[model samples]
Target chain A: MMIPLADLVTILPELIVVSAACLLLVLDPITPSNKKDLLAWMSVATLGVCFVVTAGSMGDRVFAFSDLVVVDGYASFWKLLLYVVSAMTILLSIGYLKEERIDLAEFYGFVLLSLTGMMIMVSGADLLVIYLGIELMSISLYIMAGFKRFEAKSIESSAKYFILGAFSSGLLLYGISLIFGATGSTRLVEIAAAVDARGLDDSMILIALMLVIVGFGFKVAAVPFHMWTPDVYQGAPTSVTAFMAVASKAASFGAFLRVMLEGFGGMKPNWSGLILGVCILTLILGNLVAIVQTNVKRMLAYSSIAHAGYALIGLVVAGWVGTEAGVSAKGVSSMMLYLAVYSFMTLGAFSIVAILRRGGEEGEDLDDFTGLAKRHKGAAFLMLLFMVSLAGIPPTAGFIGKFYLFMAAVNAGLTWLAVVGLIFAAVSAFYYLRVVMVMYMREPSPDQEGETRLALSPTAFVVLALAAAGVILFGLYPWPLVSLTATAALP
Target chain B: MSVPVEFYMVLSGLVFIIGLVGVLVRKNLIIILLSIELMLNATNINFVAFSSHFGNLSGQVFVFFALTVAAAEVAVGLAIIIALYRHHASINVDDFRLLKW
Candidate 1:
């Protein structure tokens, strides 16, 4: 079979990432052992180039490789977000890797590769393409999660993540097969059209939809399917946890949006109720459970799960409002904006955790953060900003994101769900505020009175700057990003 | 020479159930990993069965991709298990409670 050259060009972002991974693999041995920072810079540069290429394809829609893959405004938007998150993650990982003594080339290489997989997943128009993209992303993540092989906790986290991830993939594949058998097509657009033509029974469609939901729900860490998140997030390195919280969440949501809007547009009525129920459970359970956790990382883990629930509200509204009214666009755009803001805040929070590590020990417990304001005022201020933003306080991006999502819900007539979400939002505020109070009100430990030193690495400074700037800038003037997201409609 | 679709579905369901049981009940980490592989293979079988039934090659192509993913998953899974074993010197799931409530 002769492959079309044009299709390859359309997927240039993925190609760039794969090539970068291979280059890192080959060049690591040749470089001196002490100069591994060069590899880190190279990885950052590669992500930068990939971002540029992805941006170059903006506002241009094209189907490639017999429609197995697509390049559209939606794909470009998600690809850009993924690249940005990946780049910031690489920056965050620099000081983190040095502090932890894990200066391996393959760590950065796997991050890039996983990012490539995410890019492909967002753009994939066919079942096979989506599956490949998911695997590509997941396999790399499994390795990256366990990069600290000497740490037993890291290894256990990797194993748990792998087992759960594989199980979900199996469910997804089986669901895809069932849908293919029923509709006789694996192409998303074709599947939609087939279901329309044949008018499949409600039961069969429900079963298939349930399987897909279970699979993607696992990816997004939705309730009843989120047993592994806190363990994995707490056990993985802080930088990798940041990547998982941001990039993986965004990627999974991207894939979810595509599948629902494109593949199962006609079957919205069937799956909407299921999603609503899961969203409610996730919101209540995730937030309520997070309050009792003393480990800051685990709290953030549960917070991530709660945020997934919030994003699901947008998805529910998108499905409920139907496509003709353009409410789906608004809902999805809110989701995108929320994800963008979320990435910055979460990364900043994790970077603060990484900064507090002393002598290579992971001091991420809540007590470790007591009197952080006195020790490192700048880091404390940034952490306070992140917590406030995460709590959806006004003058921060999180508030605006939540406001738009609630507005979308009301517009879609999901008033009850919106009210439930608002109540949980209030409940979630307590934990986020607890972090701020600890930073500001509590006194520092009496270990050493004179050693009030703040270890401000250049990388931590960048992380703080980007996160604080992103939250404030996007909070004050979110219209531009909102318009950009609204314009990037799914096909 | 036609195999019924229900037969394949039933077989896949059985395989999936067994895998689920192993995942939920197994004490050894390696056994859990093996169970995940079994689940994936069941999915592949369903994909191939559907492909043949529909007279479309996409399902078969999907099966090949699934196999590749399964292999990759196994490689990573075993590597993590080995790392865990080296650390704790045992593969018992109950003993791996570093992050429990």
Candidate 2:
């Protein structure tokens, strides 16, 4: 029953976030209204420390809490990504919070706490731990989505998200229970071993796996389970929407990869076709629907769904090609790399949205950005960078991400899905480019009276710099990231 | 003292179906929330039942976690519903349609 202190050190990043969240909860009442910016800074600092701790653990693998929590290359990669995204989100929130008059200590606290949940989710080795991590993240996000207490849409969005999220959690827990019944364990590795030992192909386990997929599908905003995303993204404050778009999706995919690749590796054949069908549907539906959207935020929401579909291609390929072809780690690494790049590009895109909301107005509609190039040239440039990256144009990270994913798929003999994805990618380019054309070509709306000029906060500037740099740098020199991704083996 | 697994499975299935119907068919926001709670409790019951049937504690522990999560969800869900009610002055899903396809 003795827990090793060394194992505890391995999960220091999660510990840091938990303590920071608790600290913020306690500090909220004592801090005066004029000084609440301190809380935002504290959240940023906490995420920074967590990032350092996660970075320190790179290449070190250890299992803690009796193998219920693992620290490995995959976990470290995701933890670092989560911390970086969380930090950028806090920065983006600073300007949005000030403009919306939503400056509160609890807001930042919830962001950090939710990020803690995401961190735990990607690292959890036990099914129970995964469920707990998911709830922790979900509960915090539900509150943050409704942080604008006076806004009707914000409240509605949060209500819908909470109701649906709870329902999905139930489905996931039930699935885990069924798997536990069949395999006699909730530890993922243990469950895999049980399945192998018994050579069991129980129907109960299949149902369980399907339930889990449905549950996670909701989180990742995949088609048929993505009803809440557009509404929520449109309703929540722009900063929160950005956080939801980037961090939440990355975290869900992180856990999704772990659960499928680690827990249900043996059942790949059963679920691969189901995921493939969903991926195609999501890609087609997400892109085709996005093309008709007038609101930029809503359009991005649909685009996020389509991107999830693309990430699923990497996952399906990982399962089929890695396991079936005995490539062991290449396919999974490719999926992980896609996830990492997707996180950066998506965050950068949202960062531009966050920056453009000036003078107390949350400019989310596509028209709100008419002639933005004249109003704020630097931000317009960044926005253009994000859009091009999102469109998978050359010399941006998004292109490489999609390239590797398609390569992985083709390697797995999923040539047709890859081709179909490319077609959708081209279809998606119209909307992404439409934003660019509006920014550069249109005349500024006289009614679009702002402070006339936009200024970037230090945090937002950093986010923009990192994201823009990442898109371009990774596009130009992808070998380093590709190699790093290749080295991170999945268990 | 062995209870049938079919009984638990059937009960959970019914509860899940009820939730699905509530989400798909109900117009009242509160009813939808209640249905979600019902669905979660159904899962908890299944977890406990499986734990007992298997004579293991993992499912029981998971049930406890699920219950905790359900409680947190209700707290947040209710707060959100209350906020929505304040703004729209209605608890019906049909009333809340600012952004439509």
Candidate 3:
């Protein structure tokens, strides 16, 4: 089969990233251990180039590969965020990998490869393409979660994630097959037309929709399906955890929202209620469970689950008021903005968790943060800011993200759901503030007296600085982000 | 002269449920991996059944991708199981509980 040049050009970003990943893998064995940072830098450079290439295609909608994938403002918006997150993950890992004595160049390659999967995921307009994209992304993550091969926890997390991930993808693929059988097409546009023509009474379509939701529910770490998150987050290397928490969730949300809104827009009444139930359960369970966690990583993992709940509100509203394209746009854009703001604060928090190690001792437990203010004011202060933002306190981007989501909910005549969200946001503050209190008020334990020094490598410092700047800058001036998301919202 | 599409769907659905149950009930890591493959192949069966019924090639094309991905997953899954076995000398899922909440 002859492929057209236009199709090739449309996927240039994905091609570039994949080739760079393969190059890094080939170079890994020959590259000396001392010079592994060079591979990370190369990955970051490749992401930078892909970012620009994707930006050039922004604002223009182009379908390629027989409409299997699309390049549009919506996809580009997520792609840009994924690139930035991937670059930060690589930079943060440079210091983290070395500190943990697991500095394999293949780690960087996996990051780029998984990012390529995410990029393809957001751009996929067809079910098969999206499935392939998700599989690609997931397989890399399963490997990255076990990058610390000698460590039992790391390998265990990898096994758990692989089993659950493959299982979920199977569910996803089954749903796709059912939908195809019902509609005789896998393209979102055709699926929508078929759904509209068939009306909302089709049991097959409803079953398929539920299965798809369950599949994506597992991917985004929503409650009842979030079993793997805490273990995986707590066990994986902190840098990889950050990547999974932010980039993976964002990509999943991007594809999830697309599939729901574009493919099943006509079935709003059916899905909105189900999603509302999920949103409330996630908010309650995610926030409530996070409070009892002793390990900081597990706490963040649950907190990330709660964050997914908050984003789900946008999805619910988008479906609730699906008849009005204008109102649904607000819901969609709000979700996108929420995930974007979420990316920064969560990444910053994990960066601090990754950096606080000293001489192979992991500083991941809540007690390890005691009296951090006295030991290292800068690191403590950064953590405090992230915790504050995460708690949805004012003068932070988290508050702005929440504000818009709630506003959309209220606009869609779901003020009660907004109240439920607000209550959970308040409940979430207890844990976020506990971290603040530990850093500032409590005393460092006797045995950990000299061991809590911050290992601030220059690359990690840059990551922290970037994340902090993003949180504060977007907090103060959200118009730029608001408008960017508004323009990127699906038409 | 040909098997009805509904029969294929029913057969695949049963296979899928069996795979899911195996994943939940099985204690061995390798068995769990094989269970996942069963689930994936169930979907592949559904796709092929639908593709032939509809006379559309896209569903068949999807099966190829699914097959490739399933193979990749097994490679990665076996490698991880090997790593876990190296440390614990066992492939029982219950043995790997150092990361519990």
Candidate 4:
């Protein structure tokens, strides 16, 4: 196939990001250490441009690189979300990296590269493209996980994450090959057609679909494959943890929805049972295990796992949503909206983790929040909003996101699963509410007598404020985004 | 006559299982990474086998991409393991348990 320049035009967002990453990589070593923040700012600028380019492509149905990549509202939605995430990550980390004495210019570059990977993953139409994109995302995340080279736990997280991540990639690749064997093509459209042409009872395709789900299950940190989450989250630098929790996991959902909905929509009944099981298991374990945890980061990690489970409910609904384009209930788009909502909420919660400190140590202990409201009313209020939103309380964006998922599930006649999810949803409030209580109701810890001042960088404050504003603004007024996501349904 | 596709499938499956077992049971992180490589190569075998049986080149092409990515992952993986070794003075996965719940 002859390469055409016009095809690159369709992938303007990816192109802009790639060139910017290359430029940043080249500029990293030559630039002086003090001027490194310039590189960070420049990377943010790059993302800004990429964001505009992606936004420009919104609602256009285009495919690039020989239909290997697809461009649509779905891809546009994720790219835009990830761009905001990357920019927020850079802004939030600048001060923290300096304070911790772990400054690395390449961090920005890796982030952009990973963001580009996410863009590629969302736009991918071929399994090969998706797999490579995933590797790009995972390998970059593994390195970023260990960016604090002097910290033993950081490197340990990287090592453990790499081994297990590679093992999962093997499973994913094996699944891809099995899928190829059954369908004779790695393209999702072709695979879908093959399924329709050949019929659904092909046992090989059923087995392949299950294997593929297992692989994605690991990526999204679902119940049985989520052993690596808490340790890696607790060990990683909090900024990177925030990024991994929000952007990386959300990107995995984008890829998962694409592969499952586009490729295996024909096998809906065969796979919905498996996803339903995973969803219930994730909700039960993620919330239950979180209650016993004291570390703030680990607790949020389990919360994220539960969030993945909640988001998977959207996938299950999408599974039975059928192949018609004009279908009313777009469970996957609601999931995308849920993903965007969840990302900002998680970012806000982890931003607090990224910036807060008690004594000389950075604060991640649950007790670090005691008497927080008495000291810093703004930060405490924001944290309260984030925690409430996380528990799916009303008048927050999480509530809106959850309402959509449950509504879609019911629309698909999965009322039993939706009801079970609702019970677990209520069960989750205990821990999220505990943080609010500690911050607002409890007296300050005596050990840190005079260290009551809550400090935040201007950038972190803006990011946190932006996230909170998004949660409330969208919660009360969700019409614009609801319709946007409704239109962004996967083709 | 040529070998059956089922034969290739079984062989690749066996290799994949072996690699998976090594990864789960091995104490040395290096060996575990190597086992990951083994698992990837087993997938490559499956890809190539299917490509030949189907007389199409896409699967074979996918094998090459997977090989290159596996190399990149291993490179990054080794760098991480080495960094861990520098800090902890042991490559044993058992000793690298500082951040566990």
**lDDT digits (tens) for residues B49-98 of candidate 4:** 99999999999999889999998998998899889889989998888768
Error of 3 at A218 (Å): 0.6
Clashing pairs in model 3? none
Candidate 1: stretches off by over 4 Å: A200-202, A321-324, A448-455
| DockQ metric, candidate 4 | 0.83
Backbone clashes under 3 angstroms, per model:
0, 0, 0, 0
Point out the higher-scoring one by lDDT: 1 or 2: 1
lDDT of 3 at A323: 38
How large is the i-RMS for each model, in angstroms? 1.4, 1.4, 1.1, 1.0
The root-mean-square deviation over C-alpha atoms between each candidate and the true structure, in angstroms, is: 1.6, 1.9, 1.1, 1.6
Task: Compose the digit string of candidate 4's lDDT tens values, residues A89-182.
Answer: 9998888787677878888899989888888898899999999889999999999999988988888888888888899999899889988998
**What TM-score, over all chains together, does every model reach?**
0.97, 0.96, 0.99, 0.97
TM-score of chain B of each: 0.96, 0.94, 0.97, 0.96
Local accuracy of candidate 2 as per-residue lDDT tens digits, A1-491: 87689877877888888899999989999999888888888888988888887777788778988899988888888888788888888887776687678878788889888998998899999988888889999999999988988877788788878877887887887788778878888999988887667653678888889999999999999998998899988888878888898888888988988998789887777888888888888998999999999888899999999999998887788777334543436567777777778777888877777666645666677887889898788888988988888888888888998898888777778889889988988998999999999999999977765644554778678888988888889989999888877766584
For model 2, the stretches where C-alpha displacement exceeds 4 angstroms are A1-3, A197-201, A321-328, A445-455
Worst 10 residues of 3 chain A by lDDT: A319-328
**TM-score of chain A in every predicted structure:** 0.97, 0.96, 0.99, 0.97
Give DockQ for candidates 1 onward, in order. 0.73, 0.70, 0.81, 0.83
The lDDT of each candidate is: 0.85, 0.83, 0.93, 0.88
> How many clashes (backbone atoms < 3 Å, residues ≥3 apart in a chain or on different chains) does model 1 have?
0
Model 3, residue A94: distance off in Å is: 0.5
